[model samples]
Target: MRNIFTKLCVAATIGAAALVAAPAAHAVGVTAADTHPEQATFTTAPAGEVSIQAAGDGTPAGAIQWYKNHLGSTGWQGLCEKAAENSYGVTGVWASANAHWNGASPKHTTGTPPAGSFVYWNISAYGHVGIADGSGGFYATSVGGAIGHGSSVSYFNNYRGWTPAAVPHQ
Candidate 1:
């Protein structure tokens, strides 16, 4: 196990080095035309985890489900407004997802992001965020256009890690 771990570590280091050496920019997935609101489709096999809830009333999972259903149909601004967003896209998504949290307090989670875990990428001043579909990809706005495959995004750099803004109200 130790030898295997060491090999994996070495491979990861080499991969990182290659990325640093690459020229130009590296996008996560193929984008349509560099526009606002995208609907990304994942190439990776879906992660077998049903994290998002169908009747979410304000939680990370609910928000993800909402995005998954409304992305291409509603668009980013529309979805943000629907999620009761009063801020930027990323912030609005997080707000909407966790708005109905009935827990002690909303907190961000770290480490390996599980399904329903809100994910983010430090792209710009506001950054971009979404919920993991348990799959490698996520359901988020500003991808191809609508909330969809996160890995299928064009700018997959500047990973700011992930967090949980809220859990389901129970």
Candidate 2:
């Protein structure tokens, strides 16, 4: 027991030192005024075709990766409240729990969606929304389910329209 305690202390000391020596990599898609204190850091912009340099956030390529990330997460299902929060403060319900957008709203579009577009739906009372994977497919979260992916047919079936966001990323 004594030896194990000593080893644990040594490991903790080394971990702390490593953290202190390492540079802080800031979270993407987060702005000061819009930031959630205890939530996550994200950016809402066109950071190339990949987020984190991989397809970039808010891009078609990035949406695919984001879809995968969401699918792999647990307890992140539903929380429709955080849909926009997860999209770096874009591409989801704006000031309301509805799948609607306007010309003045960020990431608003109509007709067919291009790859990496923000997808919206008007299903039932409130709607659902997600990001386009740029492959005639989209990824969205259900009211109480984890992120899911499907064909464009599924998207258009409930489509209110699409919105292409080309704003500045933080």
Candidate 2 wrong stretches, greater than 4 Å: 1-60, 72-74, 89-93, 97-111, 153-157, 167-170
lDDT of 2 by residue, 54-152 (tens): 423544565556555445333444343244334442434354325344432455445557765666655534445566656665655541134555555
TM-scores of all predicted structures: 0.46, 0.50
Q: Number of backbone collisions per candidate, in order? A: 7, 16
Candidate 1 lDDT tens digits, 1-170: 99999999999999987842312322233244333233346332246533333425455555565555444432353232233221112232333332322221334434555666656554443445556666555666545544446543233455555555454223
Q: Which stretches of candidate 1 lie over 4 Å from their true place?
A: 1-39, 42-55, 77-111, 152-155, 165-170
Note the Cα lDDT for every prediction shown. Answer: 0.45, 0.47
Error of 2 at 41 (Å): 29
> Considering every candidate listed, which one attains the maximal TM-score?
2
Q: What TM value does model 1 have?
A: 0.46
